[model samples]
Target: MHAIIQSLCSLWQSSWQGMVMGELKYRKGSGGSGPYRVSASGRRIVRVSAVSPSGERMDLMLFPAAGFAVGGRKAEGGVYWHTFSADEVRQYSASVGDHNEIHQTESPIVSGFQIAEAMEGLEGKQDFRIRFHYPVRSGEAVSLRSEGKTVSGMTDVLCFVWEAL
Candidate 1:
């Protein structure tokens, strides 16, 4: 039964959850800014920091990332469009799958998908208004903060800025 059990474990691991996300990430925290207009049911909450914090201790707050207004406040030929989810946000070196690394998965670290890239100009048939100029990279995001604590309601978040590797 050893072989059977091993196979079962591997299968279970792959199918850990229906956590159907386009990618994965860990959220550290939002910039020291916020309360932007996100949507009719929520808020965007924005903050533009050139960089994040720095330290060796794991007990940090946010990641070393940056962000911009998801709306039209951007300058001509200096921005684009992008989108992300909460499951993608996470603490650094988090679990391989879903289940809440910060609160359930791993030993709670800070992280999230910050804006992977940003372009200057673009000309195409845009689909989403709230878009970025470039695509969100595997280890990139537009960082933000969670409300009321619990790392759940991490709204309109893009990336988490950590000190370093």
Candidate 2:
């Protein structure tokens, strides 16, 4: 039983798939696992959509569970990178009226950042990292190095951790 249990645990952890597209992606939970179960009423929903300059849309959903902590585990803040495709970014600049060449394709790249109100001194002013689980279309992978003063001296900060596949 011990050998069987250990084997199952190993297989469970090792089974996690890295980010892939145009492939049959498994719908998973906050922690990806399988023999994935579903709710009876199908009341749960997760919506994926584009803000302005629409591109790809992917959605997976599950029922909520206990303990809704605003911030995720720090140890799980793993490898991070993001790139904004020039295509989806076009209509975005038009929407924002930031037609400055500095924000457009001629600049090669643009970046963005945010800090959670929960992450203030109450949570300790700290830096976070990111990995491009999906292709970043706009305002991405930006740190204080790129944007400066992520969460310092703010009334309320809104941070978004996109998602990890």
Candidate 3:
């Protein structure tokens, strides 16, 4: 995921300077290690897609700078909360070789990958899509709630909305 982000940013003729992940769709079955094929389009909303050796696909939408809105509806009722500590965020960033400075600040924001990793029961799920609505700062608690096909992660404002595809 980090590699893909870097590649896309390079293709955009920019760095991670102002880039943000807007949405991600992953199809998990049949993928092997990639010598993947990737493509990108759009300006305001950069759309990127990757196809792996076995035809597995991942699509991503990105916003350069603050191209997308920041806040969203709060998660309500019967939700599970997870608080990612600064240390955990740092560790995950290091483990993933994503040394983005945003994740290194005193009050850092969790990376999108970390949020997705924290979600439970994703294993063996064939496909899923997640839209990032807001950033989850370090030490902030995120509420996770599942209803039918959707799963949401929220603080006071929604951070991400997820669905099984």
Candidate 4:
């Protein structure tokens, strides 16, 4: 029974990672022909067009999570890395009213607030959206990196998208 349980747990973990950290795809070009563009303020603008649409937009002014400096520059931009512990997850859950059991398990899923907190003051919250492709497990360090105008991590998984308002 012990062996069987261990095998099952291993299998589950493997499957979970596979699903969550799936292959990530991104564009490698610099420019595009769209109604929107990466603004000078690091935000994106989606102008109304004949075949396009418009809405409240905001930009993601990214910065290093560590607040470090490089080449005399105060780390203008870098990736955001964080590892949420069980206790931290619980505290965040309680504060945000997220009582899902999925967060209380051994893996201790992370909450959106946690990510937002990590990104606080770095992104324009007025017009932004966060997508959770997978719930980060406890002690699993995840890095949110800037990909052009979007922030992605974990197999290029899109963690947050910013637009202009």
Candidate 5:
């Protein structure tokens, strides 16, 4: 799950920088001024630092081990459910320039950005982390419940500058 989340974070950062998965270059090392790097320091959590071409920095953390144990408790608000179709997947893929084979699944995988967007009242630049336990297939439904002010399974660290360029 750590490796999977790391790869997804790489893909997300690449899209945020307006670059395709093939266009973004990666350096293999920790604490560097490169595209992005992932590291774990004797902690159960993993961190990923990414920088765009314009010098905007984003720090992402993955708590693969902290599943329903961390923010798993129920909160106020209804469960937000969403479903994506194969055609919608294709359209989004073209828009984001990400055509990974996993998107072709019967219940195609949805982007984290899209999931965050589905949550109401999350406008403007905001930094956040999301963990997906299951794939929301093309025809299947995926739901997100809230935990107090923040959405469940999401941690609000800071405001993130999303570049659509």
Candidate 6:
């Protein structure tokens, strides 16, 4: 995921411009495993595509962070709370090879991929769309809840919604 984001940034000739929205879709019978070849195109709205050796394809749409609203809808259903320690955040960043400065700060921001991984029952979904309203800092408490095909992560400093399609 870090490599994919870097590819997109390089294509755009920018540095951590941030994203407004993103979507991921997995092909049928394609377990969405890694070792993917990633590429990106477009300017205002970048379209990132990744293909795995096993023919699994993932398409991600990233909207630029400009003139976009930032807010989150309330999540419904059972809720679970989690707090990521600074060490945990650092470990995740190291594991993913994403040494972005923002994520290495004293109060590190949790990576979007980490947040996605924290959501339960997201596996086996054919498609899902996610919008990150704000950055979740390490040590900040986060609440997760799922209603049907939708899952949401809310924190005091950040919130995001993921809907399976």
lDDT of each: 0.23, 0.26, 0.70, 0.40, 0.39, 0.60
Best-fitting candidate, scored by lDDT: 3
Which tens-of-lDDT digit does each residue in 52-153 have in candidate 2?
111112122221222322343222232333335565455444443333342355432221211211222233433232221222224444222123322221
Selected candidate, larger TM-score, 4 vs 5: 5
How many clashes does each candidate structure show, in the order listed?
46, 3, 1, 7, 6, 0
Regions more than 4 Å wrong, model 5? 1-49, 53-55, 58-77, 117-124, 153-165
- Global lDDT of model 6: 0.60
For residues 1-165, write the lDDT of model 3, one tens digit per residue. 444434433444345445677888877646466576778887777788866666666687767646465456665664657888999888877776555677777887787767655552553445778899888889887877778988778888888888888
Lowest-scoring 10 consecutive residues by lDDT in candidate 5?
19-28
Per-candidate TM vs. native?
A: 0.17, 0.22, 0.77, 0.44, 0.45, 0.66
**Candidates in descending lDDT order:** 3, 6, 4, 5, 2, 1
Find the 10 residues in a row with the least total lDDT in model 4. Answer: 43-52
For candidate 1, write residues 19-95 as lDDT tens digits: 11122222233344423211111112222121123210111112112233233222222122333333434421123
Candidates 5 and 6 compared: the better one by lDDT is: 6
The TM-score obtained by model 3 is: 0.77
lDDT of 2 at 144: 20
Q: 1-165, model 4: which lDDT tens digit per residue?
A: 112112222222211222221111112223335453322221121111111113223212222212221122112243557667998887765655444455566677565445644554465433344444444567865665576566653423333332222
The better candidate by lDDT, 2 or 5, is 5
Highest TM-score against the true fold, candidate = 3
